[model samples]
Target: MLNTNETRIKYFFILGFPGILPEYYGPVSALLFLFYLAITMGNIFVLVFVKCERSLQKQTYYIFCHLALTDLLFGTVTLPKAISKYWFNDSIISFYSCLVQMFFVHLIGAAHSFILMVMALDRCIAICIPLRYNSLFSNKTVSVLCGISWLVPTMFMVAIMYEILRVPFCNSNIIVQCYCDHMSISNLGCDHVREVKIVALVLAMISLLLPLGFIILSFFVIIAVVLRISSIRGCIKTLSTCTPQLIITCLYYLPRCFYYLANFVGYSFSVPVQIVIVMLYSHIPAAVNPLIYCMQTKDIKEKLKKKLFSWKIDSTTKPMQDKTWQ
Candidate 1:
């Protein structure tokens, strides 16, 4: 028998419910849509700019593009659906779509963490092993690393998707956190959730904790290496090269750790708190990445600026060139 008050079941799928009430949901919905659009466009620009610039063919820039792509997929998988729910005031997610949503959210979430870990390792290599770093993390090597990073999450996501399909959603349909979360869906399960929770907890710890520890350790080694270097100019150049990457790593990891902390403590926060966390690490990271590279790398900014102003100068000189030719 069906249990949820807001939705009806037609055998396998439970119709989704209307979104939040109009008294407050309207403005909040507007804000979410605008932010998602901004994040997508901003990250696309970063990826495009990086790919087009020949000077950015180094390992660091290659990893930066991968991070930007992860951020874009991360933002896209959930934000658009959240906007739809708010616009129609309907929160009813179908059984299959909800499963797909959770799969992608976790997939991109895992990829984002792995790519950051790779970036940290890249920084370590460039700083600690300058000469061999190029051959070590060349285009082919980086591509293979990125491929494995993406595929690891995909394998787990496929397993989870298979498990989710077997369970029946006879109890609830509304997901509270603006997007589908695994634990929230597990809470509505028709069977014992112990195995699910245990698997999820283990995966979460691995995905979150392992990379975090590596980053801290890498930085510790990085700092020591920098201190031992005799030349100040060489040290400054190395440190400057890594500043943008470190800023992005902090932006992604810091708030994600907080969100996991909240989940661990069994604390109940309002919906807005969840949204804030997504903004702090998840959505905001996508936009900040492009800006970070722009500000940190003067050559990139000069290239962008030249592209921007070239149109105007070309427009002004077109007629003059024609007259000179005559």
Candidate 2:
């Protein structure tokens, strides 16, 4: 416990998966290390491909690149510290460092939510208002949309962080989850935090529900528009574009909604179970998004195949070149 006048603490101990036995730390750390590596590499591939490939320079792929950026930042912000906690026993994070982590975690997440809504809006326009999509969502317009996606969430998150900082945290300096977040950290403050909690809940709903509602409505419009098309092939082609977005959306939101509901229901879930649920919603989406959105595309798959074949040929010829030199 901190002294009464000591409103702030310097470090907060992050306890990741309290249920893990001492002997299991090695395996868990190794697994998380691999997980982080795969997610970062995959998102990087998507980001580079989008930027380098001429064919993928449209607004749609631009949104994909931003999504990749968000996923990469999110994974970097949340996972590395948790891995260190288990692997290197570096669980103590500075107070400001934890706050920075919390900011980016929520910022990237809210940005992704807004981006998904923008993607859905793009799809709706492409399908429902096909004639105007190119006009309505020009490069400048897309840039503005992307700017809004990043900015609005940041403003909200900054406000949340400010409120959290204003409250003195004289209580335990231990965070119950894998990362520092508004809810987890704010809950630890020794002050009367009922109003803080309520405000946090409202901010959460605004950050999540507003964009979510727009996404749902946009998809409904998209499906309705797609259903009206007379050509079966056209309908199939249009629906194919939406499949990845739908999958990514479900992967991102469903588990999150369930986790929130579980908490609200006051179910006595173990700490490990709660952390596992959080990991499922947050980590899995970032890890799998590149595969779903990029690799699943026929163009990207063909490009990858050609690259692999060329690499194999180079490797095969390298040995011959060495023999000749000998």
**TM-score on alpha carbons, each prediction:** 0.87, 0.91
lDDT of 1 by residue, 1-326 (tens): 34564232332222222334577667767887887887788788878887888887777778878888887887888787777766766656666677778888888888878888898888899789989898888888888888888988888777666665555555755455667768667777766466776777677677778888999999999999998979999788778877887898888888777777887899766665665565456677776777887777767778888987998899989999999999
Q: Alpha-carbon error at 27 in model 1, in Å?
A: 2.6
Look at candidate 2 and give me any clashing residue pairs. none
Q: Model 2: which ten-residue window has the lowest total lDDT? A: 1-10
Each model's lDDT comes to: 0.75, 0.85
* Tens-digit lDDT track of model 2 for 1-326: 33334687888889888878878989988988888998899999999987788877888888888898999999899999999998988889999999999989988998999888888888788888889989998877878999999999889887877778887888788888999988789888877577778877887788799988998998888888888989999989988878877888888888888887877898767878877878777888889999997666666677778879999999999999999999
Say which candidate scores most in lDDT.
Answer: 2
RMSD of 2: 2.5
Best by TM-score: 2
